[model samples]
Target: MGGVYVLGGDWLPDAGNRKVLTELPPQLAEARVCGLMQTRRREWDGAVVRDVLSERDARLVLTIPLSTQERRDSLYWMAEKRGRFTVRSCYRELVGEYEGDGWMGWTKRLLANAEALRNRWVECSRICPLCDEEEETSVHVFFTCRVAQRCWAKVRVEFAGDVRQSIQTAFQYMFSVMDADRLGFALIVCWSLWQCRNGAVWRGEAVTED
Candidate 1:
């Protein structure tokens, strides 16, 4: 106990080995000790520090020195490299007003372009064939189109009874209650609506709720 050197300031001891008060609390005392080793220009492997603490706890602190932005970028890079880019990229492609011939492509466009959606309404010849006019877009066809509203009325006559029809804010209206498969189904529903619209336009076919 005679050689014990207590510290009060943040600075580490110099090569001459004078005691510095670190003023660190118990939880931080261990970290300050480590900082001292690092500051003295001492050569200590990171593994040596890990070996001194529990594995989980040490790993948590190992990456602590990184700045906030650095940590975010590292996490994003890891996720992108792991193939999680579909949701955002798909959303952007939709916003760009892209159109496609199949389920994947059409759905992407429908979600993005209001005009393309109206065209489906027109094609169904069940009503109007325009992605514009608010009547043909995804929100309308699913929840508010006169035809669609009627369909839902059958299921819930009181549905939106006195409420005005409203557009969905895509970002705010995510189906969090659904499981992964159901979530996928929601995406598929968007795709199918686009396909139905296209069939109405090119085929001059009549559309049905089914």
Candidate 2:
């Protein structure tokens, strides 16, 4: 309602934009964006935009990528590499706790952390890209690495050194019997660790934010 989207605009508005739009006349403000382009141009009609929006908002539409080739619109989920929603990514976004999804798969040590992949004769370094300090074993990625430590620290949860030490020998057993609240927090953090690891490995994007 803050005038971010038009019925059929060529421009996609920034999701966070909430600016009030009083400049545009009702017909133009509510108008479909079908013919906003100049009569023979791929670019927006600058005067029309500048007349209806502040200079800043007008620039958004002005900078839109236009093409002469015909192409269909598509949708993708930004949260995942495949751009498709899955139970795992969806659960993480909605509940922050992956419930019983691959967050537990981290405990089973099944996903392709670098060390496990290298062990299968795959030609890759076993180093943790996030920490660059240790081999990316399930234990190292989830607990011992500096990056993992910072994630727990951000959540204001501290693990006794023994938590990682003991998990090396009995991780599954520990998770099975841990306090429910603690287990939930642990899994959530593990989900973050997995995401960071994948981003670092696959996309060269190391997520440092908490």
Candidate 3:
């Protein structure tokens, strides 16, 4: 038997695609299908890069298919079987409000406006707008930005512990950062910093965290 790939199902539209289409109209579904096709072809990076889902990807990620509880559990197991990222943390922040049995999240809202961000990245002809640091990309948006580093420093000072500098390490630090309220506040601040980075890139607006 060949490898079981998510995009390798019969060309005939399946319930999955139909569900996805309902959430994201034809144009996005086509783009998603293209991205998934690249994945089927063993192009992991291409698949992820090709994904233009942005905010929609965040929104669609949470929508569970209607089925028996057991099947739903299995589906979740497969969907979440990959390595976790900061994006998931952002998603969790939006889960209670936007996640109504669907994958809607703050990141998804940001992604919905990805084209603007992409345009700013290319045409706006600016360095990292947040701090005028380096070029804006996943690396700069999440880490390596001076403004972001400052926020992290605040967390480090408050925690009064050896705060790891790596983005992954900061996530672990979030676990022990005090009460639930403060932890959530920290997470939202991180998310806001990322969103502000995009706002600067896309809208050419420069504002600092006060």
Give the top-scoring candidate (lDDT): 2
Per-prediction TM-score, please? Answer: 0.31, 0.46, 0.35
Ranked by TM-score from best down, the candidates are: 2, 3, 1
The alpha-carbon deviation from the true structure for residue 17 of candidate 2, after best TM-score superposition, in angstroms, is 26
Cα displacement (Å) at residue 180, model 3: 1.0
Residues 64-85, model 2: lDDT tens digits: 6566765554444544776685
lDDT of each candidate versus the true structure = 0.41, 0.60, 0.45
Stretch of 10 with least lDDT, candidate 3: 70-79
* 95-181 per-residue lDDT for model 1 (tens digits): 333345423443443443344534666333234443334534556655555554444444442222323243334322433344444
Taking all chains together, the TM-score of candidate 1 against the true structure is 0.31
Clashing pairs in 3: 55-108, 55-111, 55-112, 59-103, 59-104, 62-102, 62-103
Task: Return the top candidate by TM-score.
Answer: 2
